[model samples]
Target: MTAPASSRLGIYCMLGGMFLISINDMLIKSLSGGYSLHQLVLMRSLVGVFFTLFMLKMEGGFAVLRTGRPGLHLLRALLIVFANTSLYAAIVSMPLATATALYFASPLFVTLLSIPVLGERVGPRRFAAVGIGFAGVLTMMAPQLAGKGDIGWVMILPVMAAAGYACMAVLTRKLGATSRASALAIHLQVAFVIVSLGVWAVAGDGRFAEGTDNESVRFLLRAWVWPETGDLAAIAGLGVMSAVVGYLMTQAYRLSRASTVAPFEYVLLLYSLFWGWSIFGEWPEPTVFIGAAVIIAAGVYVFMREDRVKATRRT
Candidate 1:
């Protein structure tokens, strides 16, 4: 494919994945009050694995899952596992807006890592655009950021998640040359299954969650129970979303430079705004619009700038 076309496709995949993940997160948060984290992970991973097999069939076949770079796959899986777990833990522990805002820092990490890891040239303007976009994210999240003064060290979880996720994306680009997108995704699912089962074996009885009034800790260590039919349906939705999102995210980073695709993630904030108002009835304040505008401008600048640079090289 031509560079411009490939870049656009990658952006579309990133936007689509982010849009679905926003909805999936809302559903998971709704379920977190009753279910343990490990149980949720185990259930979702099983369902996700099933769905991913279908994707595997459609996208070449099961043979595509084989990889010579097992070590990189193992590291990538560990990073993504840390990223998702830490982000989810932070979501249950703090305000969703706060956790999300903190996690958006991943784009900045991606831009920075693209330089040293991928050897991509991130120009000064592109770097500034990323910073401006992040500033916009903070602006949109200002209201939620205020009350978190007492959140203490719990706030670091999302940042850690961001770093882990950024590293994973960089690795995705590195592995994309040798592995299919489904391979990148299913390996992570297998890792999730193993980790969740290990946790269940050690503490699924709720002994650790017993006396914890802390929401995040209790959610993490809570004992598994027989899920209600409604909750099962909701988690099943998460699994489906997870499988599609996994492929979309992998394809996105695989096809474009991390720096090129990362800025488009700002659109996720807009998705959150729309979903928040429509589903949850939370009307966004003016700062949110202001921030959204800034984010959009920055993302557009990055897109045009990258396309121009690629064109110049081609010419």
Candidate 2:
């Protein structure tokens, strides 16, 4: 059946969320040259906590934070932390194209996990759409893929991150209406704060980072440094974007079937291309257009298939 009005809203939320994710990633990568992963996440999430509070006030107030599912909230927070940090490390250590193409496998994991985790049905066609979308992702980054011979082990980082993210999305669907979006976002930020502090306690002195030539490890073990005025502002911007993104992502999964919204994530690659051309001034190759066309076609097929399902129900 065609998705309900809520599901349509969910699709919009997913699209908005993915757009923010791409922008946030660009910011993260650009900033990584000077700061540690934990510092950026910690600072960004701290700012996000304030944004979350304002969102809560705007949405209704602290009373709306009531939820019987605290344990699930905690689990979701941890999964997101795992996913976020893993992807961050990957981005810092390697080219963005290689890291992203592997991480884009998330929608596939979401679709497969939804079957047993959320008890959602997947038709053959929907499965193909997700696969084709990922294929397009590969097409966009084929050169990077071809050159990563020795770094094959490193590729698993993003895939592991994808699984963590998939579990988090599926759980968001299972949580349904038990919690508000701000509550979810705040809990996640709090978790980030706690974990960031823990990492700080262990590695804050930069002792482990000594002689660490591996860039990813250095990003982890590096001592926290005070940010200058300019960089601090950029980190704060991440907080605002992250707050809005957290709400949109939670709303997306909470309001609709996971399968219905999962494929729309392919839309992120399109935004990546836009950001590349506009912000970073990278010229796109022709294959980028071919890959983009495939991605768009897959998304359109998924939308049409949903309409067909709606029509079959009416008959």
**Could you tell me every candidate's TM-score relative to the true structure?**
0.80, 0.77
Please list the Cα RMSD from the true structure of every candidate, rounded to 1 decimal place. Answer: 4.2, 4.5
Q: How much does candidate 1 score in TM-score? A: 0.80
> Across residues 170-192, which tens digit of lDDT does each residue of candidate 2 receive?
88778855776667677889999
Q: How far in Å is the alpha carbon of 24 misplaced in model 1? A: 0.4
lDDT per model vs. reference: 0.80, 0.77
Question: Residue 245 deviation, candidate 2, in Å?
Answer: 2.4
In candidate 2, stretches whose alpha carbon ends up further than 4 angstroms from where it belongs are 1-17, 127-150, 247-264, 274-315
Q: What's the lDDT for residue 68 in model 1?
A: 86
Summed backbone clashes in each candidate are 0, 1
